[model samples]
Target chain A: MSNFTIPVGPLHVALEEPMYFRIDVHGETVNNVTITAGHVHRGVEYLITKRNVFQNVVLTERICSLCSNSHPQAYSMAIEQIAGIRIPARAEYLRAIADEIKRVASHLFNVGVLAHLVGFESLFMHVMEVRERMQDVKESIFGNRMDIGANTIGGVRYDIDPERIGYLREQLAALVPEVDEIIEIYRTDSSILRRTRGIGVLSYDDAIDCGVVGPVARAAGIEYDVRVKAPYAAYDRLDVPVHVLKDGDVWSRAMIRLMEARTAIDLIHQCLDGLPDGPTVAMDERPAIPPGEAIAKCEAPRGELIYYVRMTDSPKPERVKWRVPSFLNWDALGIMLRQAKVSDIAIIVNSIDPCISCTER
Target chain B: MLDTTTIPLAVLLFPGGLFALAFGLALKGLDRRVAARLQGRVGPPLAQPFFDLVKLARKRTMVPDIAAEPVFLGTPLIGAVSMLLAAALVPIPGVYAPNPLLGDLLVLLYLLAVPAVVLMIAGSASGSPFGAIGFSREMALMLAYEGPLVLVVAAVALRVGSFSLSDIVAYQQTHGAFLFDPVMWPALLAFLAFYPANLGIVPFDIPEAETEVLEGPLLEYSGPALGLFKMMSALKAVVVLGLGVALFLPLAPDGPAGLAVHLAKLVVLMLVGVTLLRVSMGRMRIDQAFAFFLKWPLALSVLSLAIVALA
Candidate 1:
């Protein structure tokens, strides 16, 4: 019953990435927590300056697999802004399609891991099976599952033809019922609710104070989503409904992700319906780069992903930096873990959907 | 009264040692396979648990520098041995009945408690903080669940007017199994809850939740030492499930048919009670599980005991 300190990972089953937590506990209850990061840090920010503007698009996508599309998309958006390039209307809708596809996959993956951490392996497997349809669509459309390589300086790298669009529509139609079933289970299952509801609570005030974003912030009742607020790519042309909840607990976070994933499918369909006729790029030839600086932000699956690009006269950029949503969300764990049961540490950490590669990179 | 010559066969060959070990490992394999199928996965083969045991046995044991080596090394042996013996005590109705000299229901109950005790000892002696937390949680859970378990057993014993498991089984065989008897329903339900908690499945596997406490007590265990712990749990599945069958529904044909029926019932109990239940649920916190055992199972068992005594 005496106070003791336990290390919760540099390596552990619950975490997908390595980040250590030194938790001090009085018996089963956590009294304090100290987070030590930089385990998976590859110094990608520094590596970005070494690569040229066009190559860094590929480099940025490698930063985090879950938010892979967002990184390159945001970087390209920044690069396009610096070069004064307006992407073609058709390309804008194509980028949105790719973004929503990744969003559905990423959100489902996070919630699936939540089910896993909850010890509901059956539900976890079921969720993953449903998410597999999105993965298949990515593979069929972009020719790669994780890193879709769907972004370029001026616009998107890939476009959906009528056949591919039909395939996507078919997959999305099949996916809706499975996702709806999972959402219903999360809403009504006593075991999941018992473990998640009111556990690891982050208040609306605390969420704002911690500067949390995306599902974590929205779960805490903050009505903020970058797609709705900033409206990048073709999101301005599409209807993106932001899901919000009041509890700000693990269940709320998972529910927000589920709702958004379902909404992402709708957004993809909307982009397909509003498909326009034009080029998928700004121009046929590669444009010359001038010394300039610009910032671009996009709604990543986790939250708002911001890219800051500074170009010098040289082919290599002077600097490229990003602020991922996980950076702010990691700070909220101290509040969440405070006075939580030792058993809930993993569930609470998973609730924020912390992307160590994104945050540390 | 003791049949000294047949003791070794009882303990080492037919029922306890080799047979129970194989049966236990097989039960574990089936459980895993069935659970995986339930989750829509192509699971490991039925011999997977046995393969793991062989793999573990061939590996070298590594004792931590901070650990008390003797207790840490010895607890798994004790736990495995206790269950091995407990398995022998469970009568297979018309197929086999243990000798009275080999001990009875009360002795089996005490032996049944050994695995949890040694797990506690192993946890504390391992010198890992996670192990220490696991020890405390296991102890708390044991304290919570043990009351209901003992009371449920007591209710059954009072109904039959005997502490002998064979007697209880014989009584059920003639008058009708307690499984179908309305009077024994509360005790049966209490026992149903107790086995899952004792077997360390989801909603009750708090002490060694791999995510939370990193498998807690077993975090520091490695090699053949870890294999023994696995063997212990596998044997426990057989012992606990077999015990449930004997206590409530020991109605089967004589000889080989009875053995077949018993094994079939054990598999069914395992699939429905343990595997299906575990896959479908999330783990509970120790406090929540502690409260749950105290609230429902304890009350039901006490009600059964009171009713049985009066009747």
Candidate 2:
């Protein structure tokens, strides 16, 4: 029973993302977890501070591939708050629509990852095939599949017209049946249930103690979702429902993601029904950065993503400190997988939706 | 002596081991092309196997530091050799097998398992977590499919009244093929279960589950080692289908129709199977596949045996 280190990252086998975790194994059981990242680190924190607010719109999207929009939207909202500007009502609704669409695509991607991890390639392929529609919407509307540069300082830069909105509606319409099929698959696929049900159990209170946010928090029966608790953008204007499960195991987290994606789809249609006609950006030209410190929080695909800005009447911010969701969720990896079999680690790690790039940045 | 030598040489080169390899390669190519077409993409050419073999042979071998290197190195060659031997034992067109009894329907179970056991041992010796998990699951799946497959093969042997491949063919020639028999309809049902078990597709592929286990038993196999594994998989796929076809249609020893005609039938059988299996279905979960095989196909195989016994 000699202690041996099994590296699970950077270029190690099993990890799909760019982060690494070396677990100390005694025979077949993991006794300790040591994580290492920075492989995809681009020093975005420093880059964002130097760049003008307009250029950083594209810059912040690189924070996380899955939650690409939320980073920019939250950053934009922070900038607008610092200048004490009121964004156009229409702009807020559009931001909400964009965020919700991104949520659906992101959640589906994670669910597909889980399916793929469980060796259910049919469900994986189907989820991926269905996800192409979301990609289409993002490309046609935002001009890229992963990085959709939607947010401006005061509001959104582009607007979706009736024709494009109708197209978006059509894609969501087509995805509904398949989404229903996927939900049933996850529900009844007994092996998936068997492996995931009680495998990565974390009590409700333990999650809150770890400062986990979003779905991870909600799965543990904590009534704390950034979207629901502190409503921002169109979230403030409308009633947003949340899905909560008492079991904080890997499967419960997955169930929460699936339910939330459905909610996101519904939220987008609601935004479309209530979308007002007007200019996307405010009339403020040559908007200057005022002296202040502002903290912006948005429910990213993984969890609560927070960005802090400290401006001293200069265009450049004095400091840019942000907390990536993976930093928090991945810490709980040791807790979840300590005594579990070596085989369960991959799927359990996937349930956290680790954004290694964001964590490294 | 000259006449005997020429006949033996012709048999060796004509349609025995070489035919099995070519036929298996063609079926694999068809499976890939058909699967791609179903997924809406153009696939690789028919001669892709030649390129693959060349590439694999040229690549450097890296045996894992912790592995039983000799065994890991040896199993692939052994699997390939064993598969070739299995093919040689079957009655190939224009060839005389040394012993056709290995292809006897009742005793077919253990003979068919030689390649898989070699693979499992290779994976187990690799000394990686994925390999361990993969090999463990493979053993389980092996046990799962074995029961029904044995029963089905026994049913065929009962219908034919002899254990040798040549005798089974003679019976088929005398009594007509089992495809005509009502009892074999249930055996045809068993063929459905045999398909996944043979290829070890998604649901049955618990050993090499790509997403979770990171290619399972194959996690450490690269270069020439991986190549041999791939070749064995493709060849065994054809062997499995050959067993199914022989049980149902039972080849008639070419007769006046010639070697080309016999080979043409095997090729058609492989192509039809590839089309039906590759494009039409997706891999099931392991538990569901196990349940489906045991509950339905096992029952069907037993029923087929009962009907044949009565007949």
Candidate 3:
């Protein structure tokens, strides 16, 4: 009956990567949760501005292994805005292609962790297996599975050869049926449904109050994806529809990912259909270190990843700060875990795709 | 009865400690294979259990910084002992127990259950929320299944007109194995109801629901201790199958070829249980599992008891 402190994560049990939660419990109920962050801080912001804008592309990509593409894309979007360079139509299209690919892979990885945490080891392994197909696509195009370094300052560094383009389309086309099967497996299957549905209820109002973005926001019926709302890069060219859900629970989060993955496939198909003739990179001179501030938001795998860069025309930026998706999403944990039993914490935490390394950095 | 005084050394070596360990490992492997096949996959090899034990035995044991000392060490010992004691009484068809009283059916059930209980304690004593929650779920599952299982087993004891396991086996041998008694269907239903609870399969496996609870009781069990628990788990599987044989089948190992015949029958019974589990079902939800095992098994057990009382 006495109030007791129960610490979660940071060398404790987790179904996914480690994060910390100091929950004050009264019997079975959690009266309060004090979250302690900064365990995964690598001082990335301090490290990035050390290099020029060109090397910074690769440096920003290193911000997150899972959200690797988004970091570079966001950084480059800021750079493109500053340089006052209108990216070639083809370049914008390719940027969209890279962003969508990363989204699907990252979402798949999160769902796989969710499956693992839920003791649906079969589903976990199966989803990971399906994700390998995406990894193959990444490797063939970008040389890495987790950190696909595709985004560049003015446009994208990578060019898709006709053969590689054919291979990419073939992979996504083959993936569509399997994605549907995964949807059916997660949906029609009773056990998974029982574990996920209503397990972590996040109301629409709370999502906005918490500033939850991307799929979590979508699950909570927030139609505020940076891609659709304030379209940038190739997203402006493509008629991308941001997915949204009313009941923001673990199941809806998973459902959003499934739908988004399907959309990613469709978007890729569109990209290949409208493969432009011009160059992938812009030829015009990239802007000199602009002594101004630039901000850009991206739909990172976890949520809306916001990047803020303040430069004083120095080779390195004067200040760099980012609102990591996990940092923002982790705030929602205390509210979500309040009424639920202790067993649902891992599932609920996993649902938001908490990437400690990415957020802490 | 082949000189009731001194036991043969061969019997001790062949059927006592080594036999129990082998049976435990084999059953553990069998459960994995069966679970895997049902899920449309090929699981680890039959020798995987053996390999796993060897690896666990070799692992360096590190007690968690915040864990209670003996709860860590003592739980696995109790678990293994329960499994060992249960194996000693399971009647292996024709084999004779050096001590048959250890198989006091209820004693066997309690002993087999010790591993899971101790695991929960160990998980909680580790001082982590995730571990504690896992422990909580395991405790809840235990609370749900523990009563229904006892009722079912007690019903069988009533059917045989004795609580002594050997006496029940003897009774079944003489007057048609209680399984063949008119009380068979009800007892069979009760046995089926009790199976998932015993295995912690499907819905009843709330304690170790990895996605949510994160290995429940297993969250704290790492290195050598975890390995011991893992072996104890395999041993527990063997013990459960052994109980299934002793309680449900009640095979009589008597006569000139009684030893060979009874052991063979016990093996066949276990194999059948495995096959039935493989074909019949998948994991159930914790609440549904609680409901099914309690309501159905309690009703069936009550019916079986009624049949025994009337007959």
Candidate 4:
């Protein structure tokens, strides 16, 4: 009943990846939460320097599995900007399709895990089953499931043939209704509402102060999405409606992702319909890199994923630095956990969708 | 009528110890399988709970150095032994009747609470912070649910004019089941709410909310000690569900046919009330769950008591 501290998850089951929290509690209420975030550090920046620009594409994608496509996609975009190369319109659309598909899968996985943390095993299983349709599409088209090897230097690696396009459309149509059903349940279920609503409140002002990205930011009424604001890849050419909610609680964070997944499906359909006819690759010869520095940012499933690439005149060049969305969002956890009951801590932590591996990398 | 000497056999073999253990594990398996099917997956085998028990036994029993070795190791044994005795006190209408010499409905009610108390003691003794959190939640939940349960039992005892479970069964048989009596319906509903919370399933399983506290008191437990806890739960399920059968609806023809009917009723109650409910809803926080029990079930049980008194 007195003041005490509970250390959670350097290797605990509650955490998906290794990270530790020193939670100081007076009785059941959490007084303060101090987090340690270097448990999964792999020294990825040093590893990136060992590989050439061409090989770094594969290496960077391994940074985090959930946001795998965003890493390579951003890295390639940064390199293209530095070298002053223009990708064909067709390749841009292909990259958009891949990114949106990954977004849907990643967001659904986060929501499913929320269900699991709340001890709603059935919903977790059901959501994962719905997300598997996208996984199958990735495997069929891009030839891999998790790391969809879709991004190349100048263009996308795989094209949506007429057969694959038909298959993709069928999968998308099936997925939309299923996702809608799940969203409806999450919105209306009183048990879920009781656990999530008003439980982990990160005010809009605190959100902006912390610079929280993705759904966590959007939930707090921050209307900043890099895809819409900066317009990378095919986003500049297409109309992408950003999803935002006023409440900064766990429920709003979950709802933001669910609504955004629906929009991602719509974006994929538009990308396919607006297919431009041209060579998928801009040139047969690889562009030579000059000494330069460029930064590229993309809207990943979690939030804004930024890559900073600096090139010297060598095969293995200067540095490849990435600032993943989870890095900033993990810092705001202290605000969320302050005064929350011990029982709500897991759901609150999961609400931010903290990617320890992404942050530590 | 069976001789009083067979009470030991009843408690140890036929309807109590081995039989209750097997039936309870099977019910859990069915619950998991049905829940999985509802979610569109091929679930574990019907023998999965038994397999888990076996797996737990094969593992080594670990005693945390910080833990109070006596209380920590002894509570699971105490809990299992209590349920073994309680299962014998439940009379299966025309099939089997417990001897009056072996305690009655009042004793069974007291026995029903031992598992929760054991859990509280076990949690406090484990010396883990999560265990302490679990201990407090377990205590709060117990305070909430126990009041309504006692009132429910009081209502049934008043209706039969005796605290003996066999008399309650006899009264229900001749006068018709309390389940169909509109006056006793409040008690039935109250009891329905009471059992799931007692069983430590979702909506009331905040004490061991796995993601939050990592199985709470049992976090530091492993091997045969953990196996004992599993056995205690399995036996407790049979005692609670069997108690429900005796109190509300104990009407079937004597012999194996009656046993089959009783088993069928337990499976139906477990599948619908526990499994389906667990699948459909997320867990409530401890405070919310505590408030809920006090508001609805408590009021219902008090109403049942007033109805019984008036009749």
Q: Score the docking of each candidate (DockQ).
A: 0.85, 0.25, 0.35, 0.83
TM-score of chain A of each: 0.99, 0.96, 0.95, 0.98
lDDT of 4 at A314: 89
Q: What would the per-residue lDDT of candidate 3 be over residues A210-242, giving only the tens digit for each residue?
A: 988778889999888877878877676677878
Evaluated at residue A2, the lDDT of candidate 3 is 45
**Comparing 2 and 3 by TM-score, which wins?**
3
**lDDT, candidates in the order shown:** 0.91, 0.74, 0.73, 0.90
Best by lDDT: 1
Query: Which ten residues in a row are the worst by lDDT in model 2 chain B?
Result: B1-10
What is the per-residue lDDT of model 4 for residues A56-88, given as tens digits with 9 covering 90 to 100? 889888989998999999999999888888899
Clashing pairs in 2: A9-A20
Identify the CAPRI category of the predicted complex in candidate 3: acceptable
- The interface RMSD values of the models, given in order, are 0.8, 4.9, 4.6, 1.1
Best of the two (3, 4) by DockQ: 4
Better of 1 and 2 by DockQ: 1
Give the Å shift of residue B112 in candidate 2.
2.5
In model 4, what is the error at residue B224, expressed in angstroms?
A: 1.2
* DockQ head-to-head 2 vs 3, winner: 3
Residue pairs with clashing backbones, model 1 = none
